[model samples]
Target: MKKYFNWANIRLVLIVLLLAFLYAFTTKRNENRKLCNTTVEFQDGEQLFITHEMVNKLLIENKRDVSSIRKVALDLNNLENTINQHEMVEKAEVFVSIDGHLKAVVKQKTPVARIFEGSGSYYVDYKGTRMPLSAIHTARVPLVSGGVDNKNKEDLYELFRMIHDDEFLKKNIIGIQVLPSGSLIMKNRNFNYDINFGKTINMEKKFKNYKAFFQKAVQDSSIYNYRIINLKFTQQVVCTK
Candidate 1:
């Protein structure tokens, strides 16, 4: 019985050593493997700002192509950092798969409005951060001009968010101009009237009043007779002909 127990112990030790050797060998082989392929995926909807080719170009290291590099030579964190630095990229993940493939997953910024300051224009993203205009695709958002600077950008962002969230404002409002006195004037589509939105305060009530007035004006065929629709007052929409 003692001899049989000794034989069982010897077999268990050999099996354990064999498994460890196999694991080490497999790991070493995987480390030495060359990159097989690369895949780039956009998380949200279709990519509008950055292209796949642009992202691939960013993966190039010291003029060396990523696909030509070995798995051992790849710096996954560095690659991720580089892609995240792109103006349109909100976040990115870079990793190497078990099959020796490199992958990059990216999420892009969504532009809520376009701001025209002087001769140049830029986009304000949903997060209220300023983003440079994309040569790839132009977003169909409300245009803003006049008296917009760094100090008042936050206020502008709030106004843009309100407009973006409302279907009527998103469809009909074409442009917004900020006055030197910190007031806002809006331009609508298919109408020659200006919206006198004096300040950004009491926004929900102002919008509600304007909508009610617009519906009534449209029903009575009096929409085109107005030159100005003032919503600066509380609980009222004052119009001028």
Candidate 2:
């Protein structure tokens, strides 16, 4: 009886080992098979997506036999580096799917401010990251001068948000001026209305007050009646000519 019990236990162990070996062998074969399959979703910029165009340019230029375009093993860092080289691309990511499909995602920099460095001009994103202007891109954005820094750039983004969220200011905002202290001054293009929003703060209250005031002030002529709407005080709205 004891000998029979030991034999049964040994048989179970051997069976388990055999199954593990077969599983490993099958996995290796599948991995080897995957290396032969290829697929690419290249963006050629016909859709006007500039970041995709930048990435596709690098890949098409590489002489790495991407014709069959399969088995393309790309390092994520390298993919990011390639897109980062483009002035308009703020960040990028690349990954291959289980079905051997390659996908690249990019975050295009939304140029909020165009700054003059010297002879050349550069763009600043919301985070204040400065990038050079590419001739291919002519995005509508504000031009900032007087040496705006990273912190000023961030402040500008918030100020932009405050104005954009307001129903009146969103369509009317033409451009914003950034002072040395991160203060904001905006102008409307339609009638050249000046708006003084000193140091963007508590946007909810400020916007609400503007809306209420404009309800009466803009009854007839939406422009030329007020030169500037000062939103600096907490309770009073001072209009200037």
Candidate 3:
């Protein structure tokens, strides 16, 4: 019994050593492997502001192609930082697969509204941060003009968020103009009238009143009679012809 137990112990030790050696050899071989290919995937499939080629170009370092680089020399964190530097990219992740291929997963910013200020145009994302216009894709969102700056961006974002959340407003509202006095005027699609939204306060009550008025007007076939629809009042929708 003692001799048999000793033999079993020796076999176990040899097996453990062999497994460790194989693991080390495989790790070393993997480290020496060259980058086989790169894949870029966008989290938001509908909106692609950044192209795969653009991300691949960003992976290049010191005029050296990423494909020519070895796995041991790759810095995934550095690559992710470089990709995140893009104004359109909200977040990016870079990693090497077990097969020696590099992959970048990126999420682009969501533009809620487009701002046309002076001769420059840019996008305001859902997070209320300014994003540069992309040459690759254009988002069909509400156009904003006047009195839109850093100080009032968050307020505008709130207003846009409400509009985006409401299916009726999202479909009908096409433009927004901010007055110098901080009042908002909205332009509706298929209608010549402008909406006088006094201030961002009492927004829910104001939208509710406007919707009630709109539905009534539509039922009566009087939707196109007015020039201005004011929703500043507490419980009433004041209109002007």
Candidate 4:
């Protein structure tokens, strides 16, 4: 029994030493391996505004010989931050493999609406975050103009989201304008009539009435019959001929 217990202890100590040696060997091997390749990929089938070449350029700017650099020496968090700071990038994730390969996964911002204020135009992304307009691509979102205050952007964004949710509105509505009296107006793509939306309150009921009235009016009369359609009142749709 004493000899058996001594043998068991020796076996346990040898196993631990073997594990330690393997860990040290792998650690030294990984530290010595240099970065040989880099890959950049975007998620969610989004259009490429920031290309892989651009990301490679950024890496090259930080380190001229990025490919030759040791894997352990690369600052992955700093690289991720650099990519995340880009105007078009929404998120960035960096990974370095033991095989000396660096991979960067990025998510690009998606625009939901475009605001044309004064001479400049910018985009409101899906997160309701403001993003600068891209010269390479123009998003075909709702164009809002006229007297839109920056403070009221969130309110207007809700309206835009509602419009986007409705297929009829998204297909037909071309432009939105905020009047000087704090009322809202929407322009149709097919007709010359103006949709007087009044204030941004009680919009669900207002749009319901407007849609019902539009369906009936289109079947009964010509599209040119009404110059202005008012949907501001509760449970009423007032049209001016």
Instruction: State each candidate's clash count.
Output: 0, 1, 0, 0
Q: How does candidate 3 fare on TM-score?
A: 0.90
- For candidate 3, lDDT tens digit of each residue in 1-241? 3544688889999999999999999999999998888888888564468788888887755445666888998888999999999999999999999888888888998888999989998998878888999998988789999988777777789988888888998888899999999999999987999999998888888888988999999999788899999998967888898
Off by over 4 Å in 2: 1-19, 30-51, 57-61, 67-87, 117-119, 150-154, 164-168, 179-184, 199-208
Error of 3 at 207 (Å): 2.0
Q: Evaluate candidate 2 by giving its C-alpha RMSD to the native, one decimal.
A: 4.7
lDDT of 2 by residue, 1-241 (tens): 3544688889999999999999998666544443222232333332223644456656434545444443434455676687667666666666665555555666676655566656777766656577667656575555545545665556566665554445566666667666666556767656655667677576567667777776767676654677888877858778887
TM-score of every model versus the real structure:
0.89, 0.67, 0.90, 0.85
Which ranges in model 4 have alpha carbons more than 4 Å from their true place? 1-5, 59-66, 216-221
* Local distance difference test scores for all models: 0.87, 0.61, 0.87, 0.82
Q: After superposition on all CA atoms, what RMSD does each candidate show versus the true structure?
A: 2.3, 4.7, 2.4, 2.7
Native-referenced Cα lDDT, model 3? 0.87
What ranking emerges by lDDT with the best candidate at the front? 3, 1, 4, 2
Candidate 1 vs candidate 3: which has greater TM-score?
A: 3
lDDT of 4 at 103: 88
Candidate 2 lands at a TM-score of 0.67
TM-score for model 4? 0.85
lDDT score for residue 204 of model 3: 84
